[model samples]
Target: MPCLARWLVLLTLLSHSAAQENVGIGLDLSVGVEGVLPSLARPANASRIFHGIVFDAGSTGTRIHVYTFIQKDPAELPLLEKETFQSVKPGLSAYADTPETAGETVRQLLRVAKKAVPHVEWERTPVVLRATAGLRLLPPKKAQALLDEVEVAFEESPFFVPDNSVHIMNGTDEGILAWVTVNFLTGQLQAKTKKTVGTLDLGGASTQITFLPKFKKTIESAPPDHIARFDLLSTTYELYTHSYLGNGIKAARLTALGALGAEGLERKVFESSCLSRKFREDWSFGGLTYKISGIPDGSTGFTECYKEMLKVVKGVIHQPPELQDSNTFYAFSYYFDIAVEAGLIDERRGGMVKVQDYSIRAKEVCNKLSMYLATKPFLCMDITYITCLLKDGFGFKDETILKLTQKVNNVETSWALGAIFDYFQNIKIH
Candidate 1:
C-alpha cells in the first residue's frame, strides 16, 4: 500500500482502540491540572495520524518545524515520524519597523510545510507561530504588529490556522515546553520512570533551565513562577524552571560591554575586556546597532573576561540550592555550538563535559588569545561567559557534567515538538 493509505489504515485501527486507556500526549506545561480537566483527555475518535507546523521566532532567527506524528493506539501518545526543520536569519523582532517583511519570512518558510505534508491533508494541518524573547522585548505595538502581519500571512496559507496562532510566548511556557520536549524525546515520560534529565537551552536573547526537582524544598523555595506543576500520562511533575532574559550568549556580550539598554549608539562606543586589544566590530541586535571594541588600554584574557562576565551574572541569577547536587543536563543551542567549536565535544556526535571543563577550556583558549582570535575573535569571550554562566550564574558545581547535544534520537532538541503535542490536545477535529 502507498504511504497515505497505509497511514489511514493505521489511524482506523488506533481510533478503534481509543477508549482503552489514556497515555502520555504531552501537557500544557504552564497550567496545572486542577482535578483532571476535560482538555487533558484524548478524544474518543482522535486521529491517529496528523501533522503540525510550528514556527519558532527566536531572537537570532526564525525556524520552521513540520512534524508528522502517529499514535500507535488511543491509549498512547503520538509518535513523531520525523521533523522537517529550516531556519532564516534576522528574527521577526529585527523587523520592528518593517512588520510586513517579518510576515514574508513566515510565508517563505511555509513552503517547506507545503512540500512536506500531503496536498490532501493541507487544510487539516494546523500551523502556529510562537515568538520568543526577541518579540517579548520589543515595544508592545511593534510586537503586536509583527504578530498581526504573520497572522495575515498564515490566513493566506492553505493549512489550518488556529486562533491566536501567532503571538509572543511567555518565558515560563518557553522553559516548560522545552522541558517537555527533552523529556519526551528521551523516553523519560514512560510510566513508572523516575529518571529524567534536565534541559539547558541557550538561545540568543534568553536562556532557560528546567528539570523535575527531586526535593520538595526545591519547589517550596523556588519563586512561584519558577515552579510549574503539570500532569503527563498518569504522573505529576513539579519542574524547577526559569528563563533568564538578556543572559543568552549574544546578549551577555552586550551586558559584559555595558551596552544592553543604552540608547543612541551614534556617539557611544562600548568597550569590554572580553575582546582582544585589537578587536573591533559593529554588532546589531533587537533593531539597534552599536560600535563595540576591546578596551585598548586594559588587559584582555580569561581572567579579565571572567571578571567582566561576573558583573553580568553574579547576584542576578537565582541559584537553586538543588542544582549543586549531581544531575544530568542536556545543553543545546549556543551551548552545543560553543562546546563543539571549543573542542569540548564532537561536531557530528556530541559528548559530555563538566562545568570545570568549560573553565579549563576557557582558560586554555584565552591564554593563547592570538590563535583563538584568528579562528574566531569572540571565542575568548564566548567561552568565558559560558563558563561563568554555568558555574556562577546557575550555581553548578565544577564537577557537574552536562551532555552537549544538538539532537536526541535524530529529532532536534527543541520545544517545537512539545508545543505541537499541546496544540493537538486543545484543538477539536471536526
Candidate 2:
C-alpha cells in the first residue's frame, strides 16, 4: 500500500478506539440540608472544560464549579465563554458550622447558575450535569428537597432532558481507591504506616474505615520486605468497614436533638451541646484532650473542641467484643496466604473478605504507633497520614501526621485538601 494510505488507516483505527472509551460526565453539587445554611446558595463563573460541576460544599464554605466538555452535540456554544454569578452564602465555614442554611443556599446558587449559564445552548453543544459525594449524606427527605431544587434549574435548561439524563455520580472510598490503585498503581504505605490495608475517610458529616488485603500483583510474587511494600502485590478487601452514621455534625445534630429533646440547644449552640453533653452521652470522651474554656479568644475555639470531640467519639464506636474476636489476626493472615497461594486475586476483583488480616493489621499498626509517634493507634491516622501522603506523593509533615493529630489530637492534616484534589481529578477530565 502507498505510505499515505497506510498512515491514514492507522489513524482511523486509533480514533475509533478512543471513541469507545467511557468519557461520562460527572457532577458534584451540594447545599446544607439543615441548620442555618438551609437558605444558602452561591454561583460563579464556569468554563467549558469537562462536563462537570465540582461543588466544595463543606460546612466552612461553598464553591461552585460548572465545567463543560466539548459538547457532544450541537447547541452549547455560550458555555465556552465565562459566566460569573456571585455566591449567596460564600463563607467557607458556613457550609459546616451552619448546615441548616445549606439547602436554601444551594437552591439560591442553582438559580444563579441557570440564570448565568442559561438553559439554551450558545455554541450548540450537548451538555450534562453531575452531582457528587457531599449531597448524598442528606436525609432522604432533605436530599429530595435539594434534588427538587436542582430539578427546577435542570428543567429550565434546554440542554437537560426531561428524564434528568445528567448522570449523578457520588464517590465512594472504594471507587476512588479502585481508580487510584489500578491507574496509578499507588502501591502501599511502608510497614507501620497508618494507611496500609485500608482507608480512613473523615468527611464533614461522617467518618469511616475501609479495609482491603495485600496480595502479590502476580499471584506468585513473593511478599516484599515490609507488608506495606507488598501492597504492590494484588490483594483484595471485603471485611473492614465502619461508618459513624451520626458522627458528622449534621448527623450529630439530628440524632442529638431527637434523643435529648430539640430544646437542649439553639441552632448555633448545637456543637457545644455535642462536645459537652450529647457526644458524652454516646461516645467515650476519654479520648478528649482539650477544654473549650481553656482556649484563648480570637482563635477558633471550636478547633480545640473538635479534637476533644473526636476522641470522645472513638471511645464508644466499635463492634461487640465477640465480633472483634472472630476477626483475629491469625485468621486474616491465613485467608490472605491461602488466597495468594490459590491464585484468586484476579477472580475476586480485589473484593475478598480478609476479615482477620484487617484486625491483625490494625494491631500491627498500633504497635508501630507506640514506637514512631509514642502513642496508641487511632483511626484518624488513615485520613491524616495515609491519604494525604499518597495523594501528595508522600509529601507531608510527619510532625502533624504522627504526633499532634495521631498522638495528642492537637493537629490538622491536609485531608480536606487531599479529598478535594482527588475528587477534582476524578470529575474534571481537563
Candidate 3:
C-alpha cells in the first residue's frame, strides 16, 4: 500500500482499539475535566477556523449540528461562522432494545460531519452527543446501554472525542443551554445591558422554560433548583429555568389518555376525548406500540379536550410568578411546528403570537377534527396541549406575546449550538 493509505489504515485501527478499551467506563460530568483537553500549539500563520459537532439526541428525533467557528482574536470568544444540520427520525429511545442499531444511526450521522468538516481539521474538531429527554425518560440501565454503544461509535470516529462524549443531559442543563443558544444568537449575550428574552421549547418527551429574571422577588420566590447561575462569555447570569419531564407534546398525549405508566397497553385500547370520536389507530412511542382511540358514543370538542389537557398541566408544572411580567419570549420546536400546522404562524418567517392565538386555534381545530383528519389526526390534541401548557401549566397570561421562531440568523434555535459553545469554553483551547 502507498504511504498515505497505510497511514490511514493505521489511524483507523488505533481509533477502533481505543474505543474497545474505553467500553463501560463512565464519566461523571459533575467533576470538571481538568487535564483531558488536548494541548495543541497553533502556528502563527495557520487559519483560526475550527469546527464542533453536537448530536442533539432528542425524544422525537436525533439531529446532528455541525458548527463552524472563526477565532478573530485569541483573547475573545470565538464567533460562529456557519452551521449544517440533519436529522433521523424515531429518536434513540425507540431503539431501547436495539442499542447497537442506535449506534448505527449515530454512525450514519457522523458521515454528515465527515462531509461538512475538512479532513485535515477532523483530528481537532471535537464531536459530542448529548441525549435529551428521550434517554432521560428511559430506565437507567437501558439508557446507559444505549450510551455505551454511542460512546463506542464516537471513539471509533476520526473526530476528537472528549472524555464524556456521550451521556444523558440533565433537565436543568437542557433548559439553560437552550436559553444560552437563543440569547447568544439574538445578540443578547454580547450586549452590555442585556435585556434577554425568555425561551419556551416543547419537544416530544419534555418541555423547557428559561429566562433571566429581572425582579429580585421572583428569584427569591422560585424553587431553589429552578434558578441556575451559568457563566458564559466572561459573565455570570442567574437565570430561571426548568425542564418538565414527561410533559412534552407526545408524552402529554399518553398522560391524557392514561397510558403512560399503565401496563399491558398492547392489549388495551386507551381512549381520549381530545381525539376525534371516530378516530382509532396504533401509536408507537419509545419502542412500544399502543392501541389508542376515541369514544364513539361520547362527545368530543375543544371544551372536553381542554379539560383533559388540563389534567396533565394544571398542578404538574411549577409556575414562575414573574414570567407574566417579562416583556418578550421566544417559543420554538413543537410550539413552532404546531403553530405552522394550525396556520397560526408562518412556516418560514416566524411571527409574534399571543397566548390566546393557540387557544383560538385549538378550539377551531378540535371542533373541526374531521376537516383535518387525513392530514393531522392529532392536531386537536396537540394544539389543546400547547394552549393548556402555556397558560395553565406555566401560568402565562393569555395576552402574553411570544415570538415563535425556528431559527435566528440562519442557525437552529436549539441547545446544540449552546452545547458546542460550552464545550469550547470548558476546554479553553491554546
Query: Model 2, 253-313: lDDT tens per residue?
Result: 3333332223323232222321222122222111111221111222222233233344435
Tens-place lDDT per residue, model 3, 1-430, is 2222322222232233233444322222233333122122455444356678999999889999999876454334457899999999979999999999999999999999999999866776788999998888889999999999999999899988878878888888888888889988999877734699889999999999998888888889998888888665556788888899999999999999999988998689998887777889999988788999988888898999999999998778888888677568999999999999999988999999999999999999999878877789899999999999999999999999999999999999998888876665541211
What C-alpha lDDT, on a 0 to 100 scale, does residue 303 get in candidate 1? 90
Q: Choose 1 or 3, whichever is better by lDDT.
A: 3
TM-score versus the correct structure, for each prediction = 0.87, 0.35, 0.88
Instruction: Order the candidate numbers by TM-score, best to worst.
Output: 3, 1, 2
In Å, residue 85's CA in model 1 sits off its true spot by 0.6
Off by over 4 Å in 1: 1-48, 74-76, 426-430
Clashing pairs in 1: none
Those runs of model 3 whose alpha carbons end farther than 4 Å from true positions after fitting are 1-47, 427-430
Among all candidates shown, the one with the greatest lDDT: 3
Off by over 4 Å in 2: 1-50, 54-62, 67-139, 161-201, 208-212, 215-243, 249-312, 315-430
Point to the candidate with the largest TM-score: 3
CA lDDT of each prediction against the hidden true structure: 0.80, 0.30, 0.83
